[model samples]
Target: MGVFLETSRLVLRPFGAGDVDLLVALDGDPAVMRFINGGRPTSREAVEARVLPRLLRDYPWGTRGYWAAEEKGGGGFLGWFEFRPVEAENPAVVELGYRLNRSAWGRGYATEGSRALIHKGFTDLGVERVTANTMAVNTGSRRVMEKSGLTLVRHFTGDWPERIEGSEHGEVEYALTRSRWERTRQPPAAPRP
Candidate 1:
């Protein structure tokens, strides 16, 4: 029952065995999965057998893995966030990602939570860089990344196994280095006296 982190409006905690249904419902939303799995809902078997196991196993990453985001006051499930290594990439360089319910869309939860995680990663955690990727057509997600102080680093095509509707447009990567993030947090120069 490790609590990873929390923002003003959200609490990010670890997912447990009992959270399978939540993941299932979140993944089942077509609007939520529009870009992720091409609007294909995730099966219960996959959630129970594969997804839960993977999430449970990821707990060992300490504070750097997947987290279940919930409302602090109402305890409502918003979605999940991941701040971890980019699979074999530099350990100091973590990746920031999130999947929130379509109902939570349009609100500033995504940007708020992401900025908090980025601050934690650069300050409390040993992260030197943070990266995020999304379909080029996912302007909402791209805007969140930008609001979190990340800049467009690259745009490239992935060898995706499935050809989704917007896959032809390619993917985009956004990144923010610790130095850059720190600069954003620094207070402006004192009045030149």
Candidate 2:
């Protein structure tokens, strides 16, 4: 119905109004925001007054505020992931993204959640494509994108304030079209016959 998608180990649920604290904590981690903000922390007020509201306001649309990536085993929050239709003229295209705490890193949580979202985008949401973009230097994120079956689509530059070391190299976009996704999906093997 609303913003809830489930994977084997996660429940991607909507970010309630109360999740401001979570945002504060998440953005406070420098290593977590390293590639984006150059390891600076976003103020809690900024998260509450701006970011959280923007995410929460999008609930009615095909996209939700933010999906709280909760572990089904412990029912604990790992972070958040978002899969949403790009609001441009090309509305059928969705963007895939996640922001997780450092503690959640190296656990394949990003890959697992991304695969589920991609499958749903094609099979259930009638999405024509899924796209993700990040700094070219963010190899960790690039790996997740690649593992989700997206390929490098382009390299481009964007304006940034902090200007990390590799900003000059530009950013990369990885994308998967519906046809590509369908073609790449392998049929179930005959139970290892």
Candidate 3:
């Protein structure tokens, strides 16, 4: 598959079968998986059987649900991003998500990629709404969602199979609707005289 989207510094491309090692290495980092699975390192067997299958699946609209994020200049795998519909058959509402290596953190990559994906969702993908969720304690993720123009929609506990460190505090949902996005979009600057 070809590149799904691109920002000035990142390229989002569809994942391939050859990308298993990248996923394994990414999920092996404890800090990266802290909130995801309480720092448990995922086995290659799991990634091959469970994780990769989900990422490689195509949606009803003919687009893959997940994309591998890479640095534009270096072409290094950063992580993956999710922009799949909430319902399998509907394209109206899609879930937005990302999982980047710790080295990619604090560099504004998350915010940059997120804003671009949200823009693509509303402007080109016929998406009516974009939603994201993270543990309430994850202030960094929350900030990225806010920076991408999503606002807090709800806070609720999820029925996860396993409890993590911050599960007690619950989770939060942030969202932006196409109408709100249109109203808040900044117009292009006027040409200088």
Q: Candidate 3 lDDT, tens digit per residue, 34-95?
A: 98989999999999999999999999768998999998876799999999999999999999
Model 1, global lDDT:
0.83
Would you estimate the TM-scores of all the predictions?
Answer: 0.91, 0.89, 0.94
Candidate 3: where is the Cα deviation over 4 Å? 186-193
lDDT for residue 67 in candidate 3, whole number 0-100: 93
Q: Output the TM-score of candidate 2.
A: 0.89
Best by TM-score: 3
Please state the error at residue 130 of candidate 3 in Å.
0.5
| Residues 124-166, model 1: lDDT tens digits | 7778899999999999999989888899999999998999989
Estimate every model's Cα lDDT from 0 to 1: 0.83, 0.80, 0.90
Query: How does model 1 score by TM-score?
Result: 0.91
